[model samples]
Target: MISKWFDERLELQKFKDKFLNKAFPVHPTFLLGEVALFSFVTLVLSGIFLGLLYEPSTGKISLFGAMVPAAYASVVKIDLLPLGVIVRRIHHWSAMIMIASVIAHLARVYFTSAYRKPREINWLIGLGLLGITLGAAFTGYLLPYSQFSVTATSIAYYISKSVPWVGDWIARLLFAGEFPAHATVPRFFFLHVMVIPAVLVSLVGLHMLVLIKQKHTEPGANRKRKEARGGQRLIGIPVWPEQSYISVSLFFFLLFVVVLMATYIPLNPIETFGPPSPVTPVMRPDWYFLPIYGFLKLIPGDLSISIAGAKIGPEAIGGVFFPGILAFILVAIPFLDRASEAHNYIENPLHRPFMTSAGIAVAAFLFMTTVSGYIDVLHIAPASMAIYVVVVSAAAWVISYLLLRRYGRAVKKGEHVES
Candidate 1:
């Protein structure tokens, strides 16, 4: 009766025809986006549970007969609650997995040339999602108000303040004055629990709508052959059974993995770190921020320039300028490699020499920089790390370009080339 009532009111048949019966690509790589979505769902559910028990403040509270920040004390209380540790661990791991999956999904889209033409808007949206995800993670990192978190997050505080003209303003606005201030925890908590999640949810909805509109980009020229023979209809499983089955299975699998990891592996024990202190510990940002940390370490302390009476320092260069340039390049890729017509077929990376080579170089650069982030522990010199990064990235670019060009020539000549 309820179904019939809704069907009559909402035109359920039309909705099913539009979405439920639509074609969905049956590829393993396509699951990356779903994994990210599932992870986000997990985050939201876990976050709500945590938030109900959390105290988002830096105010002092009596904890175990000692004074501690309310935020830190609340975290400790949550840890004592039944299944709270597991829930927190799941939340932490889900964030990590979500970020990783988004990155991998973007990489798959890039290497397969799925960002071509009409899908450019989705590409931009995906990048926006990535930024929002990072922002979420960064804000959440400070909510515990622990020594480690405070110290690590303070690096970000300084980095924000490293901007030339309005650096101080930005830092004051974001961090609520110097790091670990009374208002800092509340500000971060609001962003992490409310603002960022709201934006993330909206963007995710738009992303799915755009995705459904554009349809999935299929791999290789097989779809082209099918299109030529029949009509331009997509060849894939219907969303009703096959795709839904896979999606359901994948979500459960993700949940199982997250639960298993949460049970076994502990993440960021704030109790051990203690509350925010004047004695800052030697700490580092999470792995996602390692590249920026590495870049900051690579630059010399003395590197600075005065521009229009404003002093631009190494922190600004490495933290702000480097990332800004990379983001610009990524955003410009679709525009720079504009297609004459809408492209629904994915191109092999080896066939696109320049794009593939640039990807290789950038990957090399990121990997080296990530390694460089641990130079203090690794006992490596900054100059040596810089030289190594440059040499390896350049060599990777040149070699990959040359090899791909050779392969292209062989394919054009119709020669049998071994992989």
Candidate 2:
């Protein structure tokens, strides 16, 4: 019965014709999704092993009760366990690679005009996956309960508190109280272990389904025919032994790298921070989230006023609203870019200027914010960094607009010449 089921699903001839036919060319960029998948696999494997040894209870359990590793010590022991450290190393490294690959894949999709028409839904799914990946990282960071984790959670708490009407409520929902308690660990553990993974898996499956249905978009003139014909057919290779070979090779290479980093650098435990304390000045979140934290600090404390007897702070407007708006804008890019022309980066600037500029602006903003946070931690003036970020962001926007104008003129000139 299993054999019949497998045979019914497998299209051996189609797989052979698609992959074995030397005519079909596979772009190196296609491997990005595979890398992400491999990372997810690594996450699952390491997570399962860690889960077995981990004690999720926040209630005061005796440190002396179990002869085996417990709580914080369990993680440390996992790192020391023959292949345990390697597993974590692979997991951590895979996460970094996964995030990076996802970004790279998005860039490839944008530059190649793959997010057009029928593929827009896939792009949105990709965006959702990106958010989930970041959330997974955030939740995973809290598991070790180290000093960095404590400080990071404090910053996260503050961010949650900035959320207007539901800020405090959201904070309570997340951490379960005023500060780090038994509830905090359990809540984060549940999210990291069960909730977020389930969402990620579902989204990933949707992303794959969309990919299989829509087919991968190609670059240059090769893609023009499909666009001209309304994209009625897919043009790509099969995902079997052919692409699988390359995918598995890349995954193992990355796994080796992850093991190397885990063994060498290891995950740092913030021993100095002691426990969650609001008075602590050295508090900072993981590097990935430093941008938001930096934005929170950059807002002027005096930039608050009473509108209709209700008070508002700059932190609320700049940190929460601005970021949320930007996220919405990013997710809505498929609708924003309405041009149907198929041109690569060099040929079409106006159509994609906003996307390119937005990417640059975000990168610059994050860099500035990260630097600003570092300076703040060192007792230096973070305001200077913030000012620089504002100046640079403004300048980038202006330059992008100018480029768009030039592109528009060029397109018009070409059209006139053809006529």
Candidate 3:
């Protein structure tokens, strides 16, 4: 009855034919984007439930017959609920999966050279989503208000203070006063539960709208262009059923995996870590942040440069400048890589030597840096750390160079034979 009523007034069939039933490219690689979107949906549902019981205040309160910070106590209370722990676990696992899938999605876009011409804005949107994901994770981590959370946050605070003249100002703004001020929890709470999520949703909607307007770029989109214009049509399933089924399947699969992990493999046990304190525990960010964390450890803590009395330290290098450069390069790819001639068709990795080599080198560096972050926690010797760093750098460069050189010759030979 509802469907008929809406269809009569709104011409629902027309809308469905025009948009809902649009064809989408079918491929395993394309599933990464769907994974990210569905995980976000799960996050929103779980976040709403958790938010109902979570007290954002950091003020002291009683928990389990002992006094604890309100934030910690609230979290404990929630955990004690029949399924609170599982829900929280699901939220955490969802965030992890979202981050991983987003990374995988971006990598697919990059390696395939899909971020070209008309798709540039979508690429920028993808970058925004990545930034927002990191923000959400950082803020959410503090809600536990455990010793590890506080300690890890302090590292973030100091990293912020590593900026130039405005470093101190930025840190002050973030904490709302000195570190662990009364306003700290509230600020993060609002951003985590409201502001950041709102922005992410807006960007995500815009990304989808843009994608639909531009249509999805597939591996051989270029080859099919002429046929498409001649009304030959493309190969794929409609979004209403076939595509929808695939998306629904991935959603359930991700949920099951996260729930299974939550049941067996535990994470972030604050019951043991206890509340915040003067002494910071061994601080480490999630795996995604490990690269930056590892890089920061390599530079001396007090290392700095004076620019007209503005102090730029090792934090500026690892936290600010390094990431800044990488982001700039990523955003500039559409313009940098044959902008005048670039097309939506994704060329094979071997056919684009420079892009392939650069991607490999960058990914290799981050992987090695993550290894370094873990190695530091084990109290490895300075000699060993140096050796590891050198070996990683050499291996990355050597492998990338060899692949490019070998592929370049093969490509040239093929072109010569064709001519």
Candidate 4:
């Protein structure tokens, strides 16, 4: 009755037929994107709740029968509210899950060569999503306004200002007067709650629109369906009942798992960390940012280069150029690889030996840097850091070489050809 009523006035049936009956391929690897999408949705819902009780001010306020910084005090008050602790922790864990899921989904796209020609624009959009997500996380990281947050923010400020030419200007723009001051919190709060979220939400909508319009890529193994004039034939169930049920089930399952995490392991106990200060603490940044932080630490602070009377140090080397080069490489993948144009059809990684091996090598370096981030926090000796650097790098390249050799022989024998 309700459906008929709505359909009569709103013509809802046309929209339902357009999207609900759409074909959707069912594959575990393909589901990674859905995981990321649901995680972001969870983040948004929990974030709105947190924003209601959160204060962006750095001023002291009397709350819960005690005096404390406005940011910290509001958080404490929120925790006292119904399901407040669970909601806040859910937000934190949701961000972590969102980042990890996106990275894995991107890796799947890369190994399967799904980012070719028609998908290049999507690839760019995905990269933008990653940047916005990270920026949102970083800005949120500082909103706690704890001692640990202040310390990490100061280190980041120094790194920004360490660049030779425009470092100082960048740092000044980021924080108006100086580090650990009242001015910075509101700026971060604005970016975290308003600017970054707006951009991210818009991009995510556009990404979904593009995906729906272009149609999904299907596994080459499914040869039963004939190819369309411009795209591959997708053989799967309609989204109306089949795909929608699974997606909704997955969303609730994810929510359950996150709730369990929030119940068991609460994130960032603000009282223990205390308020913001100049004193450096033993704590580190969130795990996702650890690699970049570790990279900056690995370089010698004393190392410097003179450029027109300005002295730039190792921060620019490990912090600037290295990361910039890596980012450029990722963005340049479609143009650099001569065979990217042929990556339209989805195929198993075994079919692309060289590309697969090269990707593995890249993963190794990222893993090495991520572990390196924990050197100081974990109290590893400097000698061990040096040794691990050499060994991890060499081992990555060696493994890639071995994979290539084995696959090369297989290709020569005409054993496994890509569809």
Candidate 5:
């Protein structure tokens, strides 16, 4: 009776036909999106527990007969709470995994040419999600109020102020005065706990709606099947039971793995770093930000340009302009590789040697720059690192292109190829 009444009012059959029975491809790469989704859910749940106990302020507070920053004191209390250690670890690992899965998902989509035609908007949305995820990580890093995190974030403070005309205004707005000021923690706390999360959740919803409308991109084999059928019907398990079961199982497995990692792996022990101090520690930013850090290091410190009464410095060049260019290229990709008609089939990267080689080259540059980011700790020379970056990236492009072309030729001659 409850089902019948709901069905009558909600038009349940139409809803089922639109969503519940939609096709879901059975591919392992497709699971990366689910991993990101589940990890974000885990982050939210764990963040709630942390938020309840956290005091987001830098003002002095009595802790164990000594005064410390309220933000640091609260984190210390959280550490003493039962299961707090594990919960914090879970949150950290979930963020790490969430970022990793999103990057992997984006790479899969790129290599397969899944951003073509109608799906371009979704691609941009995915990029927006990544930017917000990084922002979340950055803000959360400062909540511990440790020396390491403060020093690292201060790098960002200067970078923000490196923008030509409005640098000072934007830096003051973002950091709420000289960073590490009384208001800085509360501002970041608001963004981390409330504003950013709201935006992220809304974007995720829009991403899903776009996905449902455009439908998931499938393997090249699916195109052959569709052509044979003389219609655009997708071939996959229905969303109602089969895909639902798979999704549920995947979520549980991911949860288990995250918990296991939390149990075994340690992260961000605030006590070691202690409270924020004027004496900066020799530390590096997280892995995701390493490329930017490296790029910053690569640029000459004396480099500066003046235009329209605005001074542009090395910090702006490396931190703002370089990253902006990369982002612009990513946003412009679908337009650059435009298709006249709706193209749903996955393209084999091996069949498109130029594009694949370009990806490999970019990956090489990023990897080498990341290595250069650790030059101070690694005791490596800057000139040597720059030489390595150029040499390795060019070599990667050449080798990958030649190998892919040879593979294409072999396939034309009826020789079987693997991977």
Candidate 6:
């Protein structure tokens, strides 16, 4: 009687029948997202561990009665704790993997044309994730308050201050005052720990949900065949064996990279510019952002506009506003390309070649600009005329190609085809 009552209450037979009949398929490339997920998981775990030992407050505190100096000393304590160094290394390495994996995933999607049709929103979400990743990295760099961090923050300050009307206001909001203040570290700590992570987690969830709903976009030809086959679900292997294998491989690879970087190319602690000082001109941002930094510096000082009794520099418009707009455009690409004939790169080369070439050209230009910035920072004055020539040549080439495409399209339509 008791057994029957329990079975009726729990619906045991239905549960067992459903559980025992589920099928699983193993797909090789599907493991890429798994690797990224693993890295994010590692980041969260390590972050929690670090938070427990970290004092986020900017208030003065003594460590072991030694009068540990504010933000720097707290990080030092994190280093000196048992297995603290390893934990920190793991956190840093996991962050690198997360960024790398996200880039790789996006590249895979682009090359495979997985962003076509019903999956466009997922593409936008992925772009959001990229932006969040960059924001997290930037804020994380400030947490350490080392020489590199200070230099990077100084560069950030200048860029922020270059904004049109609210630039100075934004800079003050970020740093909590002029330059380095007691509130700076705490603000960054709040952003890195709570705000950005929450947003990142939400976006990641949205991306995954959309991906699952749409299913993975197979190669276009394969998709056609599958449709012809009366919608038979393609087999995918279980997450255990296939995904586990790839995840393990990626873990070891990242481990090797972390060890190599930590041992051979340890993160440089900027010693020259002690603390945040405006007198020292030696300052530069992190490498990922150097391209934009160089662009700002390249803008001429004379390009200014007077509006509302305030003078605005071209650096404000071109460097900050233009780049920010470009970023928005990039995120909206899937929506902008409204063609339905074909979506894969090979099939729609004519439609997307300009976009593809433009992307490559922009990457090349940014890389060169970054190198120029580094040269300037190192006291080796870069040739301004040479840089200008390169920039103009690239812009001219892109413009010419676009005009040729426009004329070619008009001519093709003008001449009626014999069909």
Number of the predicted model whose lDDT against the real structure is largest: 1
- Tens-digit lDDT track for model 1 on 1-419? 99899999999989888789888866668889999999999999999999999999788999999899888999999999999999999999999999999999989999888999999999999999999999999999988889988887888899899999999999999998887577888889999999999999999999999988888887676676686888777878999988899899999999999999999999899988898778976677778888888999999989999999788899999999989998998899899999999998888898999999999899899889899899999999999999999999999999999999999998977754443
lDDT of each: 0.91, 0.70, 0.84, 0.81, 0.89, 0.66
Query: Which residue pairs overlap in candidate 6's backbone?
Result: 25-236, 25-237, 26-236, 26-237
TM-score of each: 0.96, 0.80, 0.93, 0.91, 0.95, 0.75
Model 4, residue 108: what's the lDDT? 90
Indicate the residue-level lDDT of 61 in model 6.
57
All predictions: root-mean-square deviation over Cα? 1.9, 4.7, 2.4, 2.9, 2.4, 6.3
- The 10 consecutive residues of candidate 5 with the worst lDDT sum are 410-419
Is candidate 4 or 6 superior in lDDT?
4
Q: Against the true structure, candidate 5 has what lDDT?
A: 0.89
Query: Across residues 1-419, which tens digit of lDDT does each residue of candidate 6 receive?
Result: 88788879998767656442332333344456666777777788888997777765545556566543356556777777786766777777777777767876776665445676767788888888988987888888777665567667766776678787788899899877766677778888899999999999999899877765555554335556666887766444333555456567877776666655545543434233333334545566656666676666655678788888656776676567756976887677777765575342223333344655565565566666666666555554445733763775487558756865886687677775632
Number of residue pairs clashing in candidate 6, backbone atoms closer than 3 angstroms, sequence gap of 3 or more or interchain: 4
TM-score of 6: 0.75
Show where candidate 1 strays beyond 4 Å.
415-419
The candidates, ranked best first by TM-score, are 1, 5, 3, 4, 2, 6
Candidate number that wins on TM-score, 1 or 5: 1
Model 4, 312-340: lDDT tens digits are 67878777776777778889886665453
lDDT of 4 at 364: 76
lDDT of 2 at 324: 86
Query: Between the candidate structures 2 and 5, which one is better when assessed by TM-score?
Result: 5
* Candidate 4 RMSD to the real structure: 2.9
lDDT of model number 2: 0.70
Relative to the unseen true structure, what is the C-alpha lDDT of residue 345 in candidate 4, on a scale of 0 to 100? 55
lDDT order, best first, reads: 1, 5, 3, 4, 2, 6
4 versus 6: better TM-score goes to: 4
Alpha-carbon runs more than 4 Å astray in model 4: 63-67, 224-232, 308-310, 338-342, 377-384, 411-419
Task: Itemize residue pairs with steric clashes in candidate 2.
Answer: 147-270
